[model samples]
Target: MDLLVETFFNLAIMREALPLLLRGVLTTLALCAVVIPLGFAGGLVLAVLGTTRSRWKRFLLACWIDFFRAVPPLVLLIFVHSGLPFAGIELTAFAAVAVAFLLNNSAYYAEIVRAGIESIGRGQREAARSTGLTATQTLTWVVLPQAVRNVLPDLLSNTIEVVKLTSIASVVALPELLYAADMARSVTYNASPIVLAAGFYLLLLWPVVRLLSRLEHRIAG
Candidate 1:
């Protein structure tokens, strides 16, 4: 146990690595804060537009969402960061990750939102119409509220997934937590930094997962 403590719990290593890891955490959080809402909003718009009466518009949006969804996130990240420059578009590593994350996340969120919207009964729409509500008002005031409640747990779970996915940004040297861990490990020639980073991930996500479970149970009840 002494050797283990010396490797992982050494105060000198901790003092040196912890601040870098914390900075990485801040970068990840900042990305998450932007990506989550922007992705959701983009998806919501897609879902709403998908419900339109125009068949051509619906088909186009469906194709766009499917293309993004079918592409792997890492591949998309590399394509945006590396390939875009060939096409006369330039982006920083951080911007590339943001673009890829937004696109990939929006596709997932669009499908989830679509499922939630479809889950609401047609009778609800009819009831709203009978009460002299416009199509817009009916959706805003009635159907959407129920659909959102039904899918709230799933959305939160997706949020957790997003948090974990942010680690992939390390591939581009964005200085996210995983990259910080990698750098620390390289400097110390020890695996402890990686383990510490894993612990940090668990610390960050475990509570959200538990909360998601509770919410699912509550909804089921």
Candidate 2:
């Protein structure tokens, strides 16, 4: 028992690792703050364009979405960070992470938004139009509100996934929470830092998980 505790839960090592881990937490939060909004905005634009009647445009948009969705985010990130320099486009680690996550996450958010938009009935749009609202206005006032509400649970769930996915930023040495933990482990030769990182993650995500459950139940009810 002492051996196990020393290996995995040593308080001294955890204390030593705390400051670096805290900095990592802040970086992770900042990365999320930047990427999540960009993804959502990009997705909204794509979803809106998807409503176009032009068949060729739709085909191209669909292709764009599919290509990004099919590519693994880590591969995409590596390419953006490493491969793009060959094309004379060099991005910093943070910028590379932002761009890659934006591409990958936008596709996912687009699908969710599309699903939400489709759930709205044609009649409501027509009703809004008859009230002298332009198509954009109708979408803004009538369609989107209901659509977003309908998909609130899904959006929140996806956002949670995005938060978790930020850990992958560590691959580029962005010094996210996981990276910090790993560094601490290497330095101390103990697993306690990793365990502390897991505890931090659980603290961060557990409330959202409970809220998601409550939302799903409420939506069902």
Candidate 3:
């Protein structure tokens, strides 16, 4: 209790934890900021591929989706960052983590996008084709617009997942939130920094979460 009071109320505590914790928050946010957009891009690409008419291509995409979805993010990070040596392409921790996060998110968003695309009324596609639209044109101008609007809620939720998953990157010494907290504890023999770190994450995450929830309600309504 006293430790909490000292940690929360003391200027010394703030001085010590603030800088390190802020760095952690920033690093975590950076990781997510990069991964989320990349994930959306990858997901859209995969979704488009999956929607193509080629049977063999769809099979390959299913395998790609299953492989990433089956593998844990931490394990995938290791395999990509460190275990790819046998393939002669060793990736940096940042590269490996970003790739892993993006791929993981890709599987999820791809499925969501697939659902969104399918959820579009069949009549819309027929109407677009009747108006002299090619399949690609129909998809780009007609199907995608409604699909994106329909799936915005799912996309935002997935973005939150991408943000939270950055904690797993600590295992690779990515200098993200958990890594920063671990470093602080190691240096100061204090758990207070970690507590502060938790507060910071919640502080950062709360507004986004609330906004997402609000958006979900608005869309659902």
lDDT of each candidate versus the true structure: 0.88, 0.94, 0.85
Better of 2 and 3 by TM-score: 2
lDDT of 1 by residue, 1-221 (tens): 98998877766776778888888888888888888898898888888888899999999999999999999999999999989999999899889998998999988888888889999999999999999999988988988788778898988988898899999999988998999989998998776787788888999889989999999999899
The lowest-lDDT stretch of 10 consecutive residues in candidate 3 is 6-15
RMSD of 1: 1.7
Q: How much is 86 displaced in model 1, in angstroms?
A: 1.2
Residues 1-221 of candidate 2: C-alpha lDDT, one tens digit per residue? 99999999999999999999999898988999999999998888889889888999999999999999999999999999999999999999999999999999999999899899999999999999998999999988999889889998998899999999999999999999999999999999999999999898889889999999999999999
List of clashing residue pairs for candidate 2: none
In model 1, where do residues sit more than 4 Å from their true spots?
1-11
What are the per-residue Cα lDDT tens digits for candidate 3 across 60-150? 9999998988989888888888888789988888899998888898998898898899999999999999999999999999998899889
**Of the candidates shown, which would achieve the greatest lDDT relative to the real structure?**
2
The weakest ten consecutive residues by lDDT in model 1 span 7-16
Residue 87 of model 2 has an lDDT of 100
